[model samples]
Target: MNTKFGCCLIIGSFVPQTEGKDMETDKVKQLQAGLQLLEENGYDFAELTVQFLTQLSEEEFQQAKKIIQQSSLNIPVCNSFIPPQLKVVGPTVSIIELDDYLDLAMRRVREIGGEQIIFGSGGARTIPVGFSKKQGYEQIKQFLCRCESYAVKYGITIAIEPLNKLESNIINTVEEAISLAEEVNLPHIKVLADSYHMDLENESFTILKRAIKDEWLSHVHISDRERRFPGEVEGKEAMNFSKLFLILQEANYRGLISSECNAASLVDENALSLQFVKRTWSTVEGGIANVKPD
Candidate 1:
Protein backbone atom coordinates (compact mmCIF):
# COMPACT_ATOMS: atom_id res chain seq x y z
CA MET A 1 0.00 0.00 0.00
CA ASN A 2 3.00 2.31 0.55
CA THR A 3 1.08 3.79 3.44
CA LYS A 4 2.73 5.55 6.39
CA PHE A 5 0.94 5.25 9.74
CA GLY A 6 0.87 7.95 12.43
CA CYS A 7 -1.07 9.03 15.49
CA CYS A 8 -2.54 12.36 16.59
CA LEU A 9 -1.58 13.67 20.01
CA ILE A 10 -4.43 15.09 22.03
CA ILE A 11 -2.25 17.78 23.53
CA GLY A 12 -4.62 18.81 26.28
CA SER A 13 -4.46 15.35 27.79
CA PHE A 14 -0.70 15.10 27.69
CA VAL A 15 0.40 18.71 28.30
CA PRO A 16 -0.86 21.02 30.98
CA GLN A 17 -0.99 24.68 30.03
CA THR A 18 0.21 27.46 32.30
CA GLU A 19 1.11 31.16 32.11
CA GLY A 20 4.06 33.44 31.20
CA LYS A 21 7.44 31.70 31.03
CA ASP A 22 5.79 28.63 32.43
CA MET A 23 3.58 28.39 29.34
CA GLU A 24 6.60 28.32 27.07
CA THR A 25 8.26 25.79 29.31
CA ASP A 26 5.15 23.66 29.37
CA LYS A 27 4.77 23.76 25.58
CA VAL A 28 8.35 22.81 24.93
CA LYS A 29 8.20 20.13 27.54
CA GLN A 30 5.00 18.84 26.02
CA LEU A 31 6.42 18.79 22.52
CA GLN A 32 9.51 16.96 23.70
CA ALA A 33 7.54 14.44 25.69
CA GLY A 34 4.96 13.85 22.96
CA LEU A 35 7.46 13.41 20.17
CA GLN A 36 9.57 11.04 22.27
CA LEU A 37 6.53 8.90 22.98
CA LEU A 38 5.57 8.67 19.30
CA GLU A 39 9.09 7.81 18.19
CA GLU A 40 9.52 5.23 20.91
CA ASN A 41 6.22 3.63 19.97
CA GLY A 42 7.21 3.37 16.26
CA TYR A 43 5.22 6.13 14.61
CA ASP A 44 6.45 7.37 11.26
CA PHE A 45 5.15 10.89 11.88
CA ALA A 46 3.02 12.93 14.29
CA GLU A 47 -0.28 14.59 13.41
CA LEU A 48 -0.59 17.89 15.22
CA THR A 49 -3.29 20.59 15.32
CA VAL A 50 -2.97 23.96 13.64
CA GLN A 51 -4.53 25.46 16.76
CA PHE A 52 -1.60 24.23 18.82
CA LEU A 53 0.94 25.38 16.26
CA THR A 54 -0.51 28.88 15.77
CA GLN A 55 -1.13 29.61 19.43
CA LEU A 56 2.56 29.45 20.23
CA SER A 57 4.45 32.58 21.24
CA GLU A 58 7.63 33.48 19.38
CA GLU A 59 9.85 31.97 22.03
CA GLU A 60 7.60 28.97 22.36
CA PHE A 61 7.46 28.49 18.63
CA GLN A 62 11.22 28.62 18.39
CA GLN A 63 11.68 26.10 21.14
CA ALA A 64 9.05 23.85 19.66
CA LYS A 65 10.53 24.21 16.19
CA LYS A 66 13.92 23.14 17.43
CA ILE A 67 12.38 20.17 19.14
CA ILE A 68 10.56 19.22 15.94
CA GLN A 69 13.69 19.61 13.85
CA GLN A 70 15.56 17.27 16.14
CA SER A 71 12.80 14.69 16.49
CA SER A 72 12.95 11.51 14.47
CA LEU A 73 9.16 11.63 13.95
CA ASN A 74 8.02 14.03 11.23
CA ILE A 75 5.08 16.40 11.62
CA PRO A 76 3.65 16.02 8.12
CA VAL A 77 -0.07 16.47 8.73
CA CYS A 78 -2.06 18.75 11.07
CA ASN A 79 -5.80 18.84 11.80
CA SER A 80 -8.15 21.28 13.56
CA PHE A 81 -7.30 23.78 10.87
CA ILE A 82 -9.35 26.68 12.21
CA PRO A 83 -10.46 27.39 15.74
CA PRO A 84 -14.04 28.32 16.62
CA GLN A 85 -13.14 31.96 17.16
CA LEU A 86 -12.11 32.22 13.53
CA LYS A 87 -15.47 31.79 11.83
CA VAL A 88 -15.22 30.53 8.24
CA VAL A 89 -18.92 30.70 7.31
CA GLY A 90 -22.23 32.48 8.12
CA PRO A 91 -23.01 36.22 8.13
CA THR A 92 -20.05 36.95 10.37
CA VAL A 93 -17.52 35.63 7.86
CA SER A 94 -14.43 37.78 7.84
CA ILE A 95 -11.96 37.54 4.98
CA ILE A 96 -9.58 39.79 6.84
CA GLU A 97 -9.56 37.59 9.94
CA LEU A 98 -9.40 34.45 7.86
CA ASP A 99 -6.51 35.81 5.82
CA ASP A 100 -4.66 36.98 8.89
CA TYR A 101 -5.01 33.60 10.58
CA LEU A 102 -4.04 31.64 7.48
CA ASP A 103 -1.07 33.92 6.92
CA LEU A 104 0.38 33.01 10.27
CA ALA A 105 -0.98 29.45 10.33
CA MET A 106 0.47 28.44 6.96
CA ARG A 107 3.84 29.94 7.83
CA ARG A 108 3.97 28.07 11.10
CA VAL A 109 2.89 24.88 9.35
CA ARG A 110 5.67 25.23 6.82
CA GLU A 111 8.19 26.16 9.48
CA ILE A 112 7.33 23.01 11.39
CA GLY A 113 7.73 20.90 8.21
CA GLY A 114 4.03 20.21 7.80
CA GLU A 115 2.95 19.19 4.30
CA GLN A 116 -0.83 19.49 4.69
CA ILE A 117 -3.49 20.75 7.13
CA ILE A 118 -6.86 19.02 7.51
CA PHE A 119 -9.78 21.45 7.18
CA GLY A 120 -12.08 19.84 9.72
CA SER A 121 -12.87 22.81 11.93
CA GLY A 122 -16.52 21.98 12.56
CA GLY A 123 -17.22 24.90 14.85
CA ALA A 124 -15.74 27.44 12.48
CA ARG A 125 -17.39 26.09 9.33
CA THR A 126 -20.86 25.32 10.65
CA ILE A 127 -23.70 27.29 9.05
CA PRO A 128 -25.40 29.46 11.63
CA VAL A 129 -29.16 29.37 12.13
CA GLY A 130 -31.03 31.43 9.47
CA PHE A 131 -27.94 31.57 7.30
CA SER A 132 -28.66 30.26 3.82
CA LYS A 133 -26.96 26.91 3.15
CA LYS A 134 -26.19 28.12 -0.36
CA GLN A 135 -24.48 31.19 1.03
CA GLY A 136 -22.55 29.06 3.46
CA TYR A 137 -21.22 26.94 0.63
CA GLU A 138 -20.08 30.06 -1.17
CA GLN A 139 -18.43 31.29 1.99
CA ILE A 140 -16.59 28.00 2.36
CA LYS A 141 -15.46 28.15 -1.25
CA GLN A 142 -14.17 31.69 -0.76
CA PHE A 143 -12.42 30.54 2.39
CA LEU A 144 -10.71 27.73 0.46
CA CYS A 145 -9.64 30.14 -2.23
CA ARG A 146 -8.03 32.29 0.44
CA CYS A 147 -6.44 29.19 1.90
CA GLU A 148 -5.13 28.27 -1.52
CA SER A 149 -3.25 31.55 -1.79
CA TYR A 150 -1.40 30.92 1.43
CA ALA A 151 -0.97 27.22 0.69
CA VAL A 152 0.70 27.90 -2.64
CA LYS A 153 3.08 30.34 -1.05
CA TYR A 154 4.21 27.83 1.56
CA GLY A 155 4.04 24.67 -0.59
CA ILE A 156 1.25 23.34 1.58
CA THR A 157 -1.86 21.43 0.58
CA ILE A 158 -5.24 22.01 2.19
CA ALA A 159 -7.25 18.84 2.68
CA ILE A 160 -10.95 19.69 2.97
CA GLU A 161 -12.25 17.27 5.59
CA PRO A 162 -15.90 16.21 5.56
CA LEU A 163 -17.22 15.95 9.08
CA ASN A 164 -20.18 13.85 10.17
CA LYS A 165 -23.43 15.85 10.29
CA LEU A 166 -23.28 15.49 14.07
CA GLU A 167 -20.08 17.48 14.13
CA SER A 168 -20.85 19.84 11.24
CA ASN A 169 -23.85 21.22 9.37
CA ILE A 170 -22.16 21.16 5.98
CA ILE A 171 -19.70 19.07 3.98
CA ASN A 172 -20.74 15.92 5.76
CA THR A 173 -19.92 13.47 2.99
CA VAL A 174 -16.80 12.57 1.04
CA GLU A 175 -18.62 13.30 -2.20
CA GLU A 176 -19.52 16.76 -0.96
CA ALA A 177 -15.98 17.46 0.15
CA ILE A 178 -14.62 16.36 -3.20
CA SER A 179 -17.18 18.51 -4.98
CA LEU A 180 -16.17 21.53 -2.95
CA ALA A 181 -12.52 20.82 -3.60
CA GLU A 182 -13.24 20.55 -7.30
CA GLU A 183 -15.13 23.80 -7.24
CA VAL A 184 -12.20 25.48 -5.60
CA ASN A 185 -10.15 23.95 -8.46
CA LEU A 186 -6.82 25.00 -7.07
CA PRO A 187 -3.66 22.98 -7.08
CA HIS A 188 -3.15 23.09 -3.35
CA ILE A 189 -6.76 22.41 -2.40
CA LYS A 190 -7.82 18.75 -2.07
CA VAL A 191 -9.91 16.38 0.06
CA LEU A 192 -9.48 14.15 3.10
CA ALA A 193 -11.48 11.02 3.96
CA ASP A 194 -12.06 10.35 7.63
CA SER A 195 -13.21 6.86 8.58
CA TYR A 196 -14.78 7.92 11.86
CA HIS A 197 -17.05 10.35 10.10
CA MET A 198 -17.82 7.89 7.35
CA ASP A 199 -18.90 5.29 9.87
CA LEU A 200 -21.00 7.86 11.69
CA GLU A 201 -22.73 8.82 8.46
CA ASN A 202 -22.86 5.22 7.15
CA GLU A 203 -20.95 6.44 4.09
CA SER A 204 -19.81 3.66 1.84
CA PHE A 205 -16.14 2.87 1.38
CA THR A 206 -16.69 2.96 -2.39
CA ILE A 207 -16.63 6.76 -2.17
CA LEU A 208 -12.90 6.47 -1.65
CA LYS A 209 -12.51 4.85 -5.03
CA ARG A 210 -13.90 7.95 -6.71
CA ALA A 211 -11.80 10.19 -4.49
CA ILE A 212 -8.68 8.24 -5.39
CA LYS A 213 -9.60 8.25 -9.04
CA ASP A 214 -9.74 12.00 -9.08
CA GLU A 215 -6.61 12.36 -6.96
CA TRP A 216 -8.60 14.44 -4.51
CA LEU A 217 -7.86 12.28 -1.49
CA SER A 218 -4.73 13.71 0.09
CA HIS A 219 -4.87 12.38 3.65
CA VAL A 220 -6.85 10.03 5.89
CA HIS A 221 -7.99 10.10 9.52
CA ILE A 222 -9.28 6.94 11.16
CA SER A 223 -10.98 5.95 14.37
CA ASP A 224 -13.79 3.71 15.54
CA ARG A 225 -17.26 4.83 16.52
CA GLU A 226 -17.43 6.80 19.81
CA ARG A 227 -14.03 8.14 18.77
CA ARG A 228 -12.25 5.23 20.35
CA PHE A 229 -8.85 4.15 19.12
CA PRO A 230 -8.88 1.40 16.48
CA GLY A 231 -9.08 -2.15 17.81
CA GLU A 232 -10.93 -0.95 20.91
CA VAL A 233 -14.22 -2.04 19.38
CA GLU A 234 -14.78 -5.75 18.98
CA GLY A 235 -17.38 -8.39 18.01
CA LYS A 236 -20.60 -6.74 16.82
CA GLU A 237 -19.24 -3.29 17.60
CA ALA A 238 -16.25 -3.61 15.31
CA MET A 239 -16.07 -1.59 12.09
CA ASN A 240 -15.09 -3.22 8.84
CA PHE A 241 -11.78 -1.36 8.57
CA SER A 242 -10.38 -4.04 6.29
CA LYS A 243 -12.70 -2.88 3.54
CA LEU A 244 -11.46 0.67 3.81
CA PHE A 245 -7.80 -0.35 3.83
CA LEU A 246 -8.30 -2.70 0.94
CA ILE A 247 -9.88 0.06 -1.10
CA LEU A 248 -7.03 2.39 -0.24
CA GLN A 249 -4.48 -0.27 -1.08
CA GLU A 250 -6.10 -0.96 -4.44
CA ALA A 251 -6.02 2.73 -5.17
CA ASN A 252 -2.34 2.91 -4.28
CA TYR A 253 -2.83 5.50 -1.57
CA ARG A 254 0.64 6.52 -0.50
CA GLY A 255 -0.40 9.19 1.96
CA LEU A 256 -0.48 9.01 5.73
CA ILE A 257 -3.31 7.25 7.62
CA SER A 258 -3.48 8.93 11.01
CA SER A 259 -5.38 7.78 14.08
CA GLU A 260 -7.49 10.74 15.20
CA CYS A 261 -9.49 9.76 18.24
CA ASN A 262 -10.17 10.59 21.86
CA ALA A 263 -8.67 8.13 24.25
CA ALA A 264 -9.16 7.84 27.99
CA SER A 265 -5.66 6.44 28.23
CA LEU A 266 -3.59 8.28 25.63
CA VAL A 267 -0.24 6.54 26.12
CA ASP A 268 -1.47 2.96 26.00
CA GLU A 269 -4.14 3.62 23.39
CA ASN A 270 -1.72 5.27 21.04
CA ALA A 271 0.48 2.18 20.87
CA LEU A 272 -2.52 -0.12 20.74
CA SER A 273 -4.14 1.81 17.89
CA LEU A 274 -0.96 1.91 15.86
CA GLN A 275 -0.46 -1.81 16.27
CA PHE A 276 -4.08 -2.43 15.34
CA VAL A 277 -3.85 -0.34 12.18
CA LYS A 278 -0.66 -2.05 11.03
CA ARG A 279 -1.93 -5.52 11.78
CA THR A 280 -5.28 -4.86 10.11
CA TRP A 281 -3.77 -3.25 7.05
CA SER A 282 -1.32 -6.15 6.73
CA THR A 283 -4.29 -8.42 6.14
CA VAL A 284 -5.67 -6.37 3.25
CA GLU A 285 -5.07 -8.08 -0.10
CA GLY A 286 -5.39 -6.79 -3.63
CA GLY A 287 -8.16 -7.80 -6.10
CA ILE A 288 -10.60 -8.20 -3.20
CA ALA A 289 -13.03 -5.35 -3.51
CA ASN A 290 -15.57 -6.71 -1.04
CA VAL A 291 -14.51 -7.34 2.55
CA LYS A 292 -16.81 -9.27 4.86
CA PRO A 293 -16.83 -8.49 8.56
CA ASP A 294 -15.09 -11.22 10.52
Candidate 2:
Protein backbone atom coordinates (compact mmCIF):
# COMPACT_ATOMS: atom_id res chain seq x y z
CA MET A 1 0.00 0.00 0.00
CA ASN A 2 1.11 3.57 -0.60
CA THR A 3 1.81 4.96 2.88
CA LYS A 4 0.86 8.50 1.87
CA PHE A 5 -2.76 7.53 1.28
CA GLY A 6 -2.97 5.95 4.75
CA CYS A 7 -2.77 9.16 6.76
CA CYS A 8 -5.25 9.14 9.68
CA LEU A 9 -5.61 10.94 13.00
CA ILE A 10 -6.66 9.60 16.39
CA ILE A 11 -8.69 11.82 18.72
CA GLY A 12 -8.80 11.83 22.54
CA SER A 13 -12.27 10.25 22.55
CA PHE A 14 -10.84 7.12 20.92
CA VAL A 15 -8.55 6.53 23.90
CA PRO A 16 -10.84 7.36 26.80
CA GLN A 17 -9.04 5.44 29.49
CA THR A 18 -5.63 7.11 29.29
CA GLU A 19 -6.45 10.81 29.75
CA GLY A 20 -7.55 13.48 32.21
CA LYS A 21 -6.64 11.80 35.49
CA ASP A 22 -4.66 14.72 36.91
CA MET A 23 -6.09 17.15 34.32
CA GLU A 24 -2.99 19.34 34.54
CA THR A 25 -0.06 16.93 34.49
CA ASP A 26 -1.59 13.84 32.86
CA LYS A 27 -3.19 15.79 29.98
CA VAL A 28 0.06 16.71 28.23
CA LYS A 29 1.57 13.30 29.00
CA GLN A 30 -1.42 11.47 27.57
CA LEU A 31 -1.37 13.59 24.38
CA GLN A 32 2.35 12.96 23.94
CA ALA A 33 1.82 9.24 24.50
CA GLY A 34 -0.97 9.18 21.91
CA LEU A 35 1.20 11.06 19.40
CA GLN A 36 4.00 8.57 20.00
CA LEU A 37 1.61 5.68 19.50
CA LEU A 38 0.38 7.19 16.23
CA GLU A 39 3.93 7.70 14.92
CA GLU A 40 5.06 4.22 15.95
CA ASN A 41 2.00 2.72 14.24
CA GLY A 42 2.32 4.78 10.98
CA TYR A 43 -0.47 7.34 11.38
CA ASP A 44 0.33 10.84 10.01
CA PHE A 45 -1.34 13.05 12.60
CA ALA A 46 -3.09 13.20 15.99
CA GLU A 47 -6.14 15.42 16.57
CA LEU A 48 -6.21 17.15 19.98
CA THR A 49 -9.14 18.46 21.97
CA VAL A 50 -8.72 21.92 23.51
CA GLN A 51 -10.95 21.06 26.44
CA PHE A 52 -7.79 19.42 27.78
CA LEU A 53 -6.22 22.86 27.87
CA THR A 54 -9.33 24.32 29.47
CA GLN A 55 -8.28 22.13 32.41
CA LEU A 56 -5.12 24.21 32.80
CA SER A 57 -4.59 27.81 33.95
CA GLU A 58 -3.40 30.48 31.48
CA GLU A 59 0.18 30.08 32.73
CA GLU A 60 -0.11 26.31 32.61
CA PHE A 61 -1.34 26.56 29.01
CA GLN A 62 1.92 28.34 28.12
CA GLN A 63 3.94 25.62 29.86
CA ALA A 64 2.00 22.88 28.03
CA LYS A 65 2.61 24.72 24.75
CA LYS A 66 6.35 24.65 25.40
CA ILE A 67 6.27 20.91 25.98
CA ILE A 68 4.36 20.30 22.73
CA GLN A 69 6.87 22.47 20.83
CA GLN A 70 9.78 20.47 22.24
CA SER A 71 8.43 17.03 21.23
CA SER A 72 10.15 15.16 18.38
CA LEU A 73 6.84 13.92 16.95
CA ASN A 74 5.73 15.28 13.54
CA ILE A 75 2.03 15.05 14.40
CA PRO A 76 -0.08 18.14 13.66
CA VAL A 77 -2.44 19.21 16.43
CA CYS A 78 -6.03 19.78 15.25
CA ASN A 79 -8.04 21.65 17.87
CA SER A 80 -11.63 20.85 18.96
CA PHE A 81 -13.96 22.83 21.24
CA ILE A 82 -16.51 21.04 23.44
CA PRO A 83 -19.85 22.77 23.88
CA PRO A 84 -19.99 25.09 26.89
CA GLN A 85 -22.11 22.74 28.93
CA LEU A 86 -21.76 18.99 29.42
CA LYS A 87 -25.14 17.32 30.15
CA VAL A 88 -26.90 20.22 31.80
CA VAL A 89 -26.42 23.90 32.13
CA GLY A 90 -24.65 25.28 35.20
CA PRO A 91 -23.44 28.70 34.08
CA THR A 92 -23.83 28.83 30.34
CA VAL A 93 -21.70 30.91 27.97
CA SER A 94 -23.79 32.47 25.25
CA ILE A 95 -22.91 32.19 21.55
CA ILE A 96 -22.68 35.99 21.46
CA GLU A 97 -19.74 35.68 23.83
CA LEU A 98 -18.18 32.84 21.87
CA ASP A 99 -15.88 35.20 19.95
CA ASP A 100 -14.07 36.13 23.15
CA TYR A 101 -13.61 32.47 23.99
CA LEU A 102 -12.55 31.75 20.40
CA ASP A 103 -9.98 34.52 20.57
CA LEU A 104 -8.46 33.05 23.70
CA ALA A 105 -8.63 29.53 22.24
CA MET A 106 -6.98 30.55 18.94
CA ARG A 107 -4.24 32.34 20.85
CA ARG A 108 -3.66 29.17 22.81
CA VAL A 109 -3.56 27.18 19.56
CA ARG A 110 -0.94 29.52 18.06
CA GLU A 111 1.07 29.45 21.25
CA ILE A 112 0.83 25.65 21.22
CA GLY A 113 1.82 25.43 17.49
CA GLY A 114 -1.48 24.08 16.13
CA GLU A 115 -2.71 24.90 12.62
CA GLN A 116 -6.37 23.85 12.35
CA ILE A 117 -9.25 24.45 14.77
CA ILE A 118 -12.60 22.63 14.68
CA PHE A 119 -15.84 24.14 15.98
CA GLY A 120 -19.37 22.78 16.28
CA SER A 121 -22.38 24.57 14.76
CA GLY A 122 -24.37 25.69 17.84
CA GLY A 123 -25.76 22.84 19.95
CA ALA A 124 -29.31 21.87 21.01
CA ARG A 125 -29.13 24.27 23.92
CA THR A 126 -28.88 27.21 21.53
CA ILE A 127 -32.46 26.79 20.35
CA PRO A 128 -35.62 26.34 22.36
CA VAL A 129 -37.67 23.18 21.74
CA GLY A 130 -40.43 25.15 20.07
CA PHE A 131 -38.13 26.93 17.63
CA SER A 132 -38.87 26.56 13.93
CA LYS A 133 -36.27 25.03 11.58
CA LYS A 134 -36.26 28.22 9.52
CA GLN A 135 -35.50 30.30 12.60
CA GLY A 136 -32.87 27.86 13.85
CA TYR A 137 -31.08 27.81 10.51
CA GLU A 138 -31.05 31.58 10.36
CA GLN A 139 -29.48 31.86 13.81
CA ILE A 140 -26.86 29.21 13.05
CA LYS A 141 -25.94 30.96 9.80
CA GLN A 142 -25.39 34.22 11.66
CA PHE A 143 -23.22 32.59 14.29
CA LEU A 144 -21.13 30.76 11.67
CA CYS A 145 -20.46 33.98 9.76
CA ARG A 146 -19.38 35.68 12.95
CA CYS A 147 -17.04 32.77 13.70
CA GLU A 148 -15.58 32.93 10.18
CA SER A 149 -14.62 36.57 10.65
CA TYR A 150 -12.60 35.71 13.74
CA ALA A 151 -11.14 32.56 12.17
CA VAL A 152 -9.73 34.49 9.19
CA LYS A 153 -7.50 36.56 11.47
CA TYR A 154 -5.59 33.53 12.78
CA GLY A 155 -5.18 32.11 9.24
CA ILE A 156 -6.99 29.11 10.73
CA THR A 157 -9.72 27.11 9.07
CA ILE A 158 -12.73 26.19 11.23
CA ALA A 159 -14.23 22.78 10.41
CA ILE A 160 -17.84 23.18 11.56
CA GLU A 161 -19.17 19.77 12.55
CA PRO A 162 -22.85 18.88 12.49
CA LEU A 163 -23.82 16.61 15.36
CA ASN A 164 -26.56 13.97 14.99
CA LYS A 165 -30.24 14.66 15.64
CA LEU A 166 -29.97 12.90 18.99
CA GLU A 167 -27.21 15.30 19.96
CA SER A 168 -28.64 18.47 18.38
CA ASN A 169 -31.83 19.25 16.51
CA ILE A 170 -30.16 22.03 14.54
CA ILE A 171 -27.73 21.36 11.67
CA ASN A 172 -28.21 17.58 11.81
CA THR A 173 -27.20 16.91 8.18
CA VAL A 174 -24.29 17.63 5.81
CA GLU A 175 -26.58 19.41 3.35
CA GLU A 176 -27.52 21.84 6.07
CA ALA A 177 -23.88 22.40 6.97
CA ILE A 178 -22.90 22.91 3.33
CA SER A 179 -25.73 25.38 2.87
CA LEU A 180 -24.56 27.30 5.93
CA ALA A 181 -20.98 27.28 4.72
CA GLU A 182 -22.04 28.65 1.35
CA GLU A 183 -23.97 31.40 3.05
CA VAL A 184 -20.92 32.31 5.11
CA ASN A 185 -18.94 32.50 1.84
CA LEU A 186 -15.61 32.66 3.60
CA PRO A 187 -12.50 30.76 2.53
CA HIS A 188 -11.63 29.84 6.11
CA ILE A 189 -14.99 28.22 6.98
CA LYS A 190 -15.74 24.60 6.05
CA VAL A 191 -17.69 21.42 6.95
CA LEU A 192 -16.60 18.20 8.69
CA ALA A 193 -18.22 14.79 8.25
CA ASP A 194 -18.38 12.32 11.11
CA SER A 195 -19.28 8.71 10.29
CA TYR A 196 -20.97 8.33 13.69
CA HIS A 197 -23.45 11.11 12.93
CA MET A 198 -23.99 9.86 9.36
CA ASP A 199 -24.98 6.45 10.78
CA LEU A 200 -27.37 8.04 13.28
CA GLU A 201 -29.16 9.87 10.48
CA ASN A 202 -29.08 6.70 8.35
CA GLU A 203 -27.76 8.89 5.52
CA SER A 204 -26.40 7.13 2.47
CA PHE A 205 -22.68 7.36 1.72
CA THR A 206 -23.58 8.14 -1.89
CA ILE A 207 -25.72 11.05 -0.78
CA LEU A 208 -22.84 12.33 1.37
CA LYS A 209 -20.37 11.88 -1.49
CA ARG A 210 -22.45 13.95 -3.91
CA ALA A 211 -23.14 16.60 -1.29
CA ILE A 212 -19.52 17.39 -0.51
CA LYS A 213 -18.28 20.50 -2.36
CA ASP A 214 -14.57 20.91 -2.95
CA GLU A 215 -12.70 22.86 -0.27
CA TRP A 216 -15.79 22.68 1.99
CA LEU A 217 -14.73 19.31 3.41
CA SER A 218 -11.82 20.26 5.66
CA HIS A 219 -11.82 17.22 7.97
CA VAL A 220 -13.41 13.82 8.61
CA HIS A 221 -14.23 11.71 11.69
CA ILE A 222 -14.51 7.93 11.40
CA SER A 223 -15.91 5.20 13.67
CA ASP A 224 -17.97 2.01 13.44
CA ARG A 225 -21.74 1.60 13.86
CA GLU A 226 -21.59 1.35 17.66
CA ARG A 227 -18.91 4.05 17.90
CA ARG A 228 -16.42 1.25 18.54
CA PHE A 229 -13.05 0.66 16.94
CA PRO A 230 -12.85 0.07 13.20
CA GLY A 231 -12.78 -3.60 12.10
CA GLU A 232 -13.77 -4.85 15.57
CA VAL A 233 -17.38 -5.21 14.47
CA GLU A 234 -17.85 -7.01 11.19
CA GLY A 235 -20.66 -7.27 8.60
CA LYS A 236 -22.48 -4.61 6.51
CA GLU A 237 -21.95 -1.91 9.13
CA ALA A 238 -18.18 -2.16 8.83
CA MET A 239 -18.35 -2.51 5.05
CA ASN A 240 -19.99 0.91 4.73
CA PHE A 241 -16.74 2.63 5.68
CA SER A 242 -15.03 1.15 2.59
CA LYS A 243 -17.59 2.93 0.44
CA LEU A 244 -16.99 6.16 2.34
CA PHE A 245 -13.26 5.90 1.84
CA LEU A 246 -13.78 5.16 -1.86
CA ILE A 247 -15.78 8.36 -2.26
CA LEU A 248 -13.03 10.32 -0.53
CA GLN A 249 -10.35 8.76 -2.70
CA GLU A 250 -12.31 9.38 -5.90
CA ALA A 251 -12.66 13.01 -4.94
CA ASN A 252 -8.91 13.22 -4.21
CA TYR A 253 -9.58 14.57 -0.77
CA ARG A 254 -6.37 15.06 1.18
CA GLY A 255 -7.13 15.79 4.82
CA LEU A 256 -6.93 14.01 8.15
CA ILE A 257 -9.48 11.34 9.10
CA SER A 258 -9.63 11.60 12.87
CA SER A 259 -10.86 8.46 14.69
CA GLU A 260 -13.23 9.96 17.24
CA CYS A 261 -14.88 6.79 18.47
CA ASN A 262 -14.93 5.48 22.03
CA ALA A 263 -13.14 2.30 21.02
CA ALA A 264 -12.48 0.72 24.40
CA SER A 265 -12.33 1.08 28.18
CA LEU A 266 -8.60 0.49 28.67
CA VAL A 267 -5.51 2.10 27.17
CA ASP A 268 -4.27 -1.20 25.76
CA GLU A 269 -7.66 -1.88 24.20
CA ASN A 270 -7.58 1.58 22.63
CA ALA A 271 -4.14 0.80 21.23
CA LEU A 272 -5.64 -2.24 19.55
CA SER A 273 -8.32 -0.02 18.04
CA LEU A 274 -5.68 2.28 16.59
CA GLN A 275 -3.97 -0.73 15.03
CA PHE A 276 -7.29 -1.94 13.62
CA VAL A 277 -7.94 1.46 12.00
CA LYS A 278 -4.55 1.45 10.27
CA ARG A 279 -5.14 -2.05 8.92
CA THR A 280 -8.55 -1.01 7.57
CA TRP A 281 -7.08 2.03 5.82
CA SER A 282 -4.45 -0.15 4.19
CA THR A 283 -7.14 -2.46 2.86
CA VAL A 284 -9.25 0.42 1.55
CA GLU A 285 -6.33 2.10 -0.20
CA GLY A 286 -5.09 -1.17 -1.71
CA GLY A 287 -8.39 -1.63 -3.54
CA ILE A 288 -8.18 1.88 -5.08
CA ALA A 289 -4.42 2.32 -5.53
CA ASN A 290 -4.81 2.07 -9.29
CA VAL A 291 -6.93 5.22 -9.62
CA LYS A 292 -5.19 7.89 -11.72
CA PRO A 293 -3.99 10.92 -9.82
CA ASP A 294 -5.62 14.22 -10.68
Q: In candidate 1, which residue pairs get closer than 3 Å at backbone N, Cα or C atoms, i.e. clash?
A: none
Candidate 2 ranges beyond 4 A from true positions: 1-22, 74-79, 86-96, 121-126, 211-213, 236-239, 289-294
Q: Please, what are the lDDT tens digits per residue for candidate 1 over residues 39-148?
A: 98888899888877777788788888999999999899888888886799887878888888999999998999999999998999999999999999998999988888
**Candidate 2's error at 135, in angstroms?**
3.2
- Candidate 2 lDDT, 29-143, residue by residue in tens: 7666665665665555556675665556777666667666665544344544644442111233366456666677666665666666766534423455665557656656655
For all the candidates, what are their Cα RMSDs to the real structure?
3.4, 4.7
State every prediction's TM-score relative to the real structure: 0.93, 0.80
Which prediction has the highest lDDT against the true structure?
A: 1
lDDT to native, each model: 0.86, 0.62
Among all candidates shown, the one with the greatest TM-score? 1
Error in Å for residue 101 of model 1 = 0.7
